[model samples]
Target: MILRIAMIGFGNVGQEFASMLLARREWLLKDRGLDAEVLAIYTKSRGALLSKRALDLGKCLELVRGGRNLSEYGPESTSLSPVELISKCNADVLIELSPLNIESGQPAIDHIVAGIENGMDVVTANKGPVAFAYKRLRNLARSKGIHFRFEGTVMDGTPIFNLVEKTLQGCEVLGLEGILNSTSNYVLTEMTSGKTVEQAVRAAQKGGFAEADPSLDLEGWDAAAKITALANVLMDADTTPKSVDRQGIGGIEAKDIERASSLNKKYKLIARAEAAGEGIRLSVRPEMIGPDSTFWSVDGTSSALTIRTDLMGDLTILETNPRVTQTAYAVFSDILSVLESIRAGTAH
Candidate 1:
């Protein structure tokens, strides 16, 4: 069975995912017995392209590298929004890689809904929809009998969600604490070395870890969104970034960093969500952790999550250095999961 895929965004993560798919095509077909094709691609600035036939990914890469739009490709090209493409494209899966809008989960939320309603499985790297509307989308997918997976929402393709779902079976998740934002973590690590917050943020931006407008990362909105996503999925609660109490690293001073160092501790931006009575309590704050703490050793652009469970006790997962490729790999892993479910005759 050929799984036709429609990509909703053409940015850095999208480009990396497409390239990895092409590079691993033969291996996927031969070892995994899975065949897939890219049917359509829709970009914000580059227009859209759709075809009933399989799209030439190599040609798509060429077009992207040359700084050309999809409209310049062929007759099938047209300037359609992501919603239009999702409604019209004859694809088995919809890959949503668009920019996240936590304020109002637009375009991405609408696109995912359209795909599920049209009888297609949805995979997304965007966190807005999951953070704001997980229960609604999950219920919609359940009623439609399709899978909705967002493995890249939290830790740039870390297996947090999958580990909870697949590995931690029969164990109840009581609570979770994590360093969810790489940009903020990088800034704090740099600050510990005597660099000012501005210098650290600039270094992060140059390293491609922080965005040009990093208000979300610096103001704790990014980590808040991630923790909200985690709470919705693991704790089965509905929450948003605004609902999560947030505190960023911008307020940390050189004296504060030095004080932590003097006490043999490190300041880290930690996002925590725990089961409180019937609801979940969430907060993102800068905390000084001692050497014995699981997060104290996590430095640089790395992330760590410690899940408190009933049967399994405390489980800590760490990603030493996560990058774009790891996030792309997360998307790829989700696709393979969809395919495996179908192969097992479980996918609806």
Candidate 2:
């Protein structure tokens, strides 16, 4: 099968996908019996344009790394910005990995709504818009009969959606919990370095684990958003970001970390969503778990989610990574899985 992919965000995750699509071109064609093309990538300003049809994968990577090109098309000056690209691009699948704006979900929400309306399938790693408009956007996609796959939105790309959707199909997850944010975890891990929370956050941003505005992860808003997505999709509940009570690690004073050390109990951003009767309760907060506790060991930007099922009781405790390398691979895994299912006409 052949496919055309429209990548909406050219950030670290977006660029990672581009690189992956290039690296695996030969393998995907020879092994998976799949032929594909990255139509284009819409980024902040004049996006990137590469036609792998003629260029070798290695040459493509060289151009991307140098931020220059050797094609008839000049680099950076010939492509549309992410916004204009979303509204104007053409493709069978739209990969939306744009940055998340919690307040508006802006471009992402608009992009997704527009994509579905135009009859294009969407796959994303952006949690802000999904966590904000789960019901509205989900209904829209379902009505349009488009596949909205978002496997990398939560974990370090640990296959959470289908882990719950398909693997535990007949079961019920009463309690969902995990280290949903890696930025905060990294900050906490650096507590012994004597760096202030602000200093640690800056380091995380420099390392590409946190965003320019790290409040989303530090304030627990990022984790809250993930919990909200889980509740809405896995639990079949209609909930919004505001509905999920949130608390961040921003308020943790230097003394608190010191105190935690004295008590031998550490603090970590724990996100939880529980089935409370007909309604669900979700929250993101920094809690103190003991030295040997399960959550206490989940450090840095790595996240772990444990699902308490009815039949199997407590099963696997899944973890998600924050690196784009892992996340982008997860994106491709999901893309191929969904595409294969679609081709077989057996996807649900």
Error of 2 at 142 (Å): 2.5
The sequence of per-residue lDDT tens digits that candidate 1 reaches over residues 1-348 is 689999999888999999999999999999887778998999988868999998888888889878987787798797777888888998999999999897977778999999998899999999999998999999999888798999998888989999989998888889999998899999889988899988998999999889999888999999999999998999887878788988988899999999999999999999999877878999999999999998878999999999999999999989988889988999999999988877776742
lDDT of 2 by residue, 1-348 (tens): 777777777667877877888878899999898876665565564335544343243554565566864343454234555546555556667888888777766779888887788777788888876787777887888888778888888785788787887777789778788888888888987875588888898888888778888877888878888888777778776777777789998888879988988898888888888877778999888888897767777877677887778977876565645567878987888788768767876533
Using lDDT as the measure, the top candidate is: 1
Top TM-score prediction, candidate number: 1
- Judged by whole-model lDDT over C-alpha atoms, candidate 1 comes out at 0.90
Error of 1 at 242 (Å): 1.4
